[model samples]
Target: MKSPGIVIVGAGQSAAVAAHALREHGYRGHIAMLGREWHKPYERPPLSKAVLVAAQEPLLDVLAEEAWARSNIELLNGSDVAALDLAQQEVRLANGQTIEYEKCLVATGGEARTLLCCPPYRRRVHYIRTLDDARRLRAALQRRPQVAILGGGFLGLEIAHAALAVGASVTVLERATSLLDRFLPPEVSAWLQSNLCRAGARVLLGTSVSDAFPVETGRMLLATDAGARLEVDEVVVAIGLSPNDALARNAGLEIGPGGGVLVDANCRTSNEHVFACGDCASQQRPGQSQPTRLESWQNANEQARTAAAAMLGASPPKPPVPWFWTDQGAHNIQMLGLPADDLEYVRRGDPTNAKALWIGHRRLVPIHAVAINAGSELRALRPLFDRDQPVQLQDFHLDTLNLRAWAKQQALADAAVPR
Candidate 1:
């Protein structure tokens, strides 16, 4: 019998990972990857950091061309899957071409959330969601334009860091009173704000753009809700991302709470043969009450693998402990597990040092850990999360001894690993 083949949509991080995973699992069936972008899949994290500062293009492939060729996975770039015919088990592209598949993976990511702007301001304002967006913004940054980043999230702060490195005057305006309000705790948010301020970027809180009018050829006058007007050469909006679940929803698939395609523990969507992962898929954690759609690069890679395995009739993979990191001008914030506003903070290490760990605990158990410039420590302590037993604070001191060795002495490995 001929294999019905698998069709994966949206050539982003998740799609690329899924393609490689299916091949790695010894699936010899036909595989097709469809993308809306003309360029092949590349890393998105660099689009905000390295890509912005580099003088030349950086090769940002999740999976290299040679590997794809060896794997025999067809890359159909510039083909947007406009609609999915669920009954026929096929997808119709924007160009009116339809392709049949036994199973499909909807890895369509998202677009940057747009802000209201005045006439002539639309073209001048920038939004970074893709490599092309970053390329254009990078070109504009060369002029050392006074850039006003319209959001204070990680992406916006990362861009500000890049702009500051290039000698551009940077001003960040956020709608909320604090930066990264949705994810980071208030203390972390203040720390980030102070760092940006120290890096010579003006950080404003509780302010949002009401309108942006173009008074000159390249300059834009932005009027804020607080009745303040700031004129800048360029404006970049990094407010947030809206999930690209239109295709899934249009196909009568279940949509999750956060505008994501709802999926189960195995990353299987409403349509059994059809799966979803990455930023587009919403999944509920074991201990968590609500469904979550993680937008981090870690989630994208992990979820893709899960979706690929499930499609191959393998048992569901174990859920991963959520981990994400952000690189500012001089600070690298690496966090393990989810951060909650109500969680009590247990400060570890020298508080005076800029590089320190902020561990969050719920009563006795260590629920989350946020480390600054402590990636190694975070990775070492990751196994602790798999254990049901609480990681005691009395075990060792940050003042001396190896944290990794001490952690192992506690027999974290002996603890049952949760799925």
Candidate 2:
């Protein structure tokens, strides 16, 4: 096999995006994406929702087989990289094959965090991090068994809703005092808790599984810290993920405090020819004290483009505002900007009954915003965060709020002026 011009270490979303971006930017040389998974690259978002509920597997392919061939991109699935020979500028696979590269991108992403207590009871406990994991969990859910979801984050909640759709009773256990407390404001957190309750999910905040034992009916008995005993047929753990940075770390590349491969604004790692992106990358953006690792789809795609541009020695566009969305039953929650606990929140309309918008700001200058079932309006108000503009409280009122109309006028006004 010919040596690849750009060797991408992981064949996940970031790897697919980077390979395509390199081609788009006119880097005509050979490109290869190496992944540990047997399947082609696909998105991970639908694993908990669509994959769990639907009989037909969702077509979430990032780079289809035909597309890869058409783009002249080689996809080496089920190829595990043992170590990186930085000095030799080569990626060594576990099978003793070495692939030389002009540039290397480490997009290994992350692995799901598992509990030490549940490893012994693998048959009853499940964790979703890959397509195969989702398929296995989905088959388990088809039995409509009582499910206990550990953690109240996006993945856990989505799984709860999916289980409910399949006639399964779900109980969500979160260790925090409130659901999504780390990323959301207190009031918003309360609002989400209420929604979960209304959707038939029994949410237990500040509770965690203390011990688990097999019961007579072949179900697991869970003892909670709150001194409550619960029996469930299946347990799904959605705690979080640990970055897959062992390859970079073993190669002596710098790692960030968040346990990710450290990369600069251009996604360039310690070695100029080596780059990192996606969930595995801890990025040092412009004007930030500490490096942060964002585990979102948008971040993965954006960083892929940035790294591709850097590979070709071209100027990359500025990173967009951090954004993420989660679909929980009837509600679609979208959050903009980096999460900050210090921001004061201003509410618009009722969050439980009707759609609502929570603007989190410091001294009235918008820093972050959360839209509950109001994505388009949130997009209209997105430009506000880019500029240092102070928003008046009165503008958020349902009777007066017309951000879309206001944004349209601004667009028309800007278009009328001569360049």
Candidate 3:
């Protein structure tokens, strides 16, 4: 006569998408989403880029106010989930209240990792995780603050770009030998570092902070592992993120690499009624060896939609090609899949060329594409990845590649379409 309640935990992008997917699939059951953040769900990408430079429109509303009301999905803000009692189908919140549900989704995403400096200097270190964190960092960058960034990853370089744009002198300390070494190859990392230097920011590789002694006038005398020292007005610690998968672990659910909830291709966890997605969920693709958790806006939305459908007895959507984008300074970096060691990558154009595209190939088969400000063209090549004949470099240079049209012929030639 009535449908059971479906409770979605965490109010981030994935949690919001889960609510929308449940309604889109015609599930008229009771739906509730609880988020720990004080504000309603907002996009986080701009936190490192546009939000730092200027104020913009709100990125809210996975389900707008009226949409939530009309769809009968309860919006519970500031509700921090503490524990889950799977046997009893109840979740205990931080306020000591238990909410009952027939099915639960854990989408509590990750948090920005902080520095391990002196206890008193913790407040001096800034991290950008939420809207409020971004706002605070933006305010601190008002009058050209000398900024010291502690990492050389995408987020760190992004913040460095923003800081440099506002007339701030920036110095980045990266423990690794190259910038974005973990994600990008040496050639790409060199290009990014060159841009950072050209933008009036100093990039220091193989360097780390030993101590941050507070000096007069809100500055810190920083000591480095490489025997260097500098005083900066503000410090940004954008090292990385740690997944928020403790609730799933507490419920005795299987955990994957990097401390994320282990879920299958269908987003089902060890518990039959429990599912997880987004940065908090770790999964292994068919061809991959190690289980990985992707932290991107695309992953958050797509995985949640799939997990919600599976929970509602619907066929899951086809998995995507794992595309992600980053905006740093004035460049738009779009990537399809990550750089793999086994794949031999080829660049369509020279690195000095503005419209260059990098394609990774293994045995002459396309596996990945990395482009700068060439997103539309890069996206068109997705269907042709490892499915068609080896793409010719001359075709890419001459702008004569019609990947979509070529992929259409694949069904006739191979009798199978990639999902």
| Estimated TM-score for each candidate | 0.94, 0.94, 0.92
Alpha-carbon RMSD to native, per candidate: 2.9, 3.5, 3.3
| Sliding window of 10 residues with minimal summed lDDT for model 3 | 410-419
For model 1, what is the error of residue 354's alpha carbon versus the real structure, in angstroms, after optimal superposition?
A: 1.9
Ranking by lDDT: 2, 1, 3
In candidate 2, what are the lDDT values of residues 1-419, reduced to their tens digit? Answer: 45769899999999998998898889999888899999888999889889988879889988776766667878899999999989999999999999999999999999989877676237878899999889888888889899999989988999998889888899999998889888888877888888778878899888988887778899988899879999999999999999999999999999998799999999999999999999999987533569989999999999999999999999987889889999888689999887676788887767756588888877666678898898887798677667645555555666575777764444334333222
Considering summed lDDT, which 10 consecutive residues are worst modelled in model 1? 410-419
How high is the lDDT of residue 283 in model 2?
Answer: 87
After TM-score superposition, what is the CA distance of residue 2 in candidate 3 from its true location, in Å? Answer: 15
Better of 2 and 3 by lDDT: 2
Clashing pairs in 3: none
- lDDT of each residue in 60-102, candidate 1, tens digit only: 9988878866778778999989998899889999999898889
TM-score of 1: 0.94
In angstroms, give how far residue 178 of model 3 lies from its true place: 1.3
lDDT of 3 by residue, 202-230 (tens): 89999999888788776877899878898
Best by lDDT: 2
